[model samples]
Target: MPEVWERGADDEFAGRADDGSYDATARVVDARGVDDEQRVEAALRPKRLADFPGQPRVRDQLSLVLEAARRRDAVPDHILLSGPPGLGKTTLAMIVAAELERPIRVTSGPAIQHAGDLAAILSSLAEGEVLFLDEIHRMARPAEEMLYLAMEDFRVDVIVGKGPGATAIPLELPPFTVVGATTRAGLLPAPLRDRFGFTGHLDFYSSDDLAAILVRSARLLGVEALDDGIAEIAGRSRGTPRIANRLLRRVRDWSQVHGRGVVDLEAAHEALALFDVDVRGLDRLDRGVLELLCTRFGGGPVGLSTLAVAVGEEPDTVETVAEPYLVREGFMVRTPRGRAATALAWQHLGLTAPMDAPGAGAPQLPLDGEGRFS
Candidate 1:
């Protein structure tokens, strides 16, 4: 977790010139017409469980758990939501609050540094409040230990003072729910993982679910979309509602510029192609990473650092964006040694598969791919 101190929304992004600070959220900074696209998408994000598409079984299971908790007037058990990015983990956190009719206080792991920092946030929680801790696995070690006791005993032991005079102050915290979301659940300590009442693993959405999400999002955006266009977009969305909404927004842009009245199949296809996304939906950068790994590293049992250097990208970016989908699509595998791009890598990239490949496997989309809406 990166500790980026909170600043005003109107704060200008401190460019790379000053202390090499990079604001990843710069794209969301106040701008003109282009920024509106980003803001509108935020408005389109689902606020309720019923509106959040995909991962239906988890939602149903969660609903029962929350309802049961609310019936007893208790904070619902701590939930751990783990998945790849853009899988609506945050949205589900909000939905949990909405269903329980409780207030939600949102913060990330990096935001809490020292034990005192954790104490500040924990002490302020109202009874039955939902303390949404996004990326909980990335919390600092001291804070994480504090959280363990808080989750386990409904109390936080805060250390006051320093050195020889330091004293532990045990504070009674609210009986609140901790909805922790993480892209890398494996990084969480075993003690932390065990503390959660329910561990929900969010998986990729299927084409049909993605399509339904597209329909819902398009309705929100006031964009008329044909059924074929919806399906095509869904298929190419990389199985994320956020990406589906992004593709739709881009199509709307192209439609306005090309004099197309609404998003039809042709407009959608053209818009995606212009953005360097293919029919099977691998984007240019995605293919770039895989191609380098396959051809340069000879299908790679390559270490992540070596691969990152090969592709001229940060190890984290390679692991996060380019790697997860490739792994899930069976284009890569995470061995004990390193990452190995698979036979599907060759097939997807139009290369010949080796006669005996180690990582050759079928792509079975996870349970989240099953049609929940149907």
Candidate 2:
């Protein structure tokens, strides 16, 4: 049986704070504390499931989850939201709290470096509360282990004294839902991953979805935008709502400063071009990688580090920022040898591929009679 302790209630948020007293519950009430730009970003975030654009499957599934919990009058099960950044994982977590009418405690995995840190937060959760843990994969190992038991049994053991003479005092917690968001789901341990009753994987939005998002953002920001303008910006938004909104704002600036105070097609094109975003959503850094591969590296079987050096960026940035979209759009390939350019990349850069270039419509080679490479 789980031990029950009636310690006085204290709410705790997972984000960093330097305070000894845990009496006050930390809340991400709004975007008020952040800079003006982030405040605007928050204002543009959709408040409900209906308003959020793209990721239909995730939306529908999350709707059912929230609806089922509502029908039962019980706290929703722990949910794991996995996706690339800027695809609305955090937004969806906030929306979940709104739809449930629950106060949310927001924090990130990196903030909880010790088991005690996680335990302190877990022990303070109010009944039926929602806890949004962002970048959950970055949490420390001991903290993660502590979280597993907490998620399963709603209890955490408070350790006292040194390891040899330590005693664990079990503390029972109220029923609360953890809404964890992670950019890299693969990094989560199997035990932690299995604890979540629901999981949502958000993919990049389509051009149409991005356009709709931009239109919604424009209305909220009071920007006059033509449909063609919205469509143009969306096509170059890198298939992300965050990027779409950012591009829309940039275009709005351009329209106000240079052209009429309206986001027209010309304004969208000129603004994006000035920012080095091409029509297909490839930015200067993206094109630099492609150009380096096709022109300098001869279509590249080059290592990521080598490529990054050539482009004057960190290897992680090259891999995480540029490579995913490039690979997704068929512009590049992660070969066993290394990163290589596809024929599409050459064409996109307005360059013809050499006859012997990788992915340049090469014919299949004949196999020997012994089934060996010819």
Candidate 3:
């Protein structure tokens, strides 16, 4: 866990002390900094689909869908965007609204606790408006049911009263579009999933694409970044654009304070190092999991909960946040027994894999021609 810095009235930020230097306690390397990103992400977001980078297939498909709707002079089909966090799912939703030249109403699944809450929002939506529901998988069951009828039939049944006296007043709604974004698409009910006319899955971006995103972000933020500095941050961003932008800001801070107000390769390295991010984009928690697996467990299969306990983290955090990247990068494997470190993990940690270690002589899986196991 990252250290906590107590905030003072005089402190410029919770993560900074009265002095100019960073407290070194903030979680600067986390990809899921939703609260922090919200403050600056709006300005950095691409307003239109044409301005967005990466996800070529999704971009093209979305463009065609929007253009077709425009030619028809009607609302576009409901769009479902599925992907890991921080890969521009929300941005794409906003872009859909922008491209259609319509107003957008943004809400998340957790915010809609009741069917009535969803009913109110749906009834008030103007024709052609886009409703962007984020984290759609976590929506309450009743609200999810309510959304189903609204999406398909453009109507909602608003219940009025209680018990047998309750009456579901059929409410006709204006034709509109729903752009739903979910990090875990599978959790969405099949009926709700099927309601979407277009589904787009976003993949992790390539280094070149991430570099392009960084260049654009630097220009927007007015940060003078060298080519190598941008490349360095992009390489260590774990294939996520949000992480890349956050690291760029930290490197910019480091440049302003220590260097000559310019983001260069050295500034990027120093900033990332101070934030506890390694060259391979592994932060403290990530390295902790690998170190414990290789050093303590003898590279044997270990239960997820056991690993999480040893790392002082929740099991869900270990599984969702750390495990995906570790497994995807070939540093770990999920065996029938449990989680086990691979030979790559040992090599990355500068240790040798024992002959009895799990995955020591295991057959390597074939890559899908994308540097990922098929």
| Best candidate (score: lDDT) | 3
Q: How far is candidate 1 from the true structure (C-alpha RMSD, Å)?
A: 7.2
- Clash pairs, candidate 2, are none
Better of 2 and 3 by lDDT: 3
* Number of colliding residue pairs in each model: 0, 0, 0
Q: In candidate 2, what are the lDDT values of residues 1-374, reduced to their tens digit?
A: 22222332363334324443433334334565567777788899999998888899999999999999999999999999998889999999999999999999999999999999999898888999999999999999999999998999999999999879999999999999999999999999999999999999999888889888888899988989999999898878777888888889999999999989999999998999899999888999999999999999999889999999999999999999999999988799998889999887998889998766666886545854222498
Over the full model, what C-alpha lDDT does candidate 1 score relative to the true structure? 0.83
Give each model a TM-score. Answer: 0.81, 0.86, 0.87
Q: Model 1: what TM-score?
A: 0.81
Q: Which stretches of candidate 1 lie over 4 Å from their true place?
A: 1-39, 293-306, 333-343, 351-374
lDDT tens digits by residue: candidate 1, 70-160: 7988888999999988888998998898888899999999888887888898899999899999989889999999899999898987777
| Residue 247 in candidate 2, Cα distance off native in Å | 0.5
lDDT of each: 0.83, 0.89, 0.90
Error of 3 at 271 (Å): 1.1
Candidate 3 lDDT at 340 equals: 93
- lDDT accuracy of residue 211 in candidate 2: 82
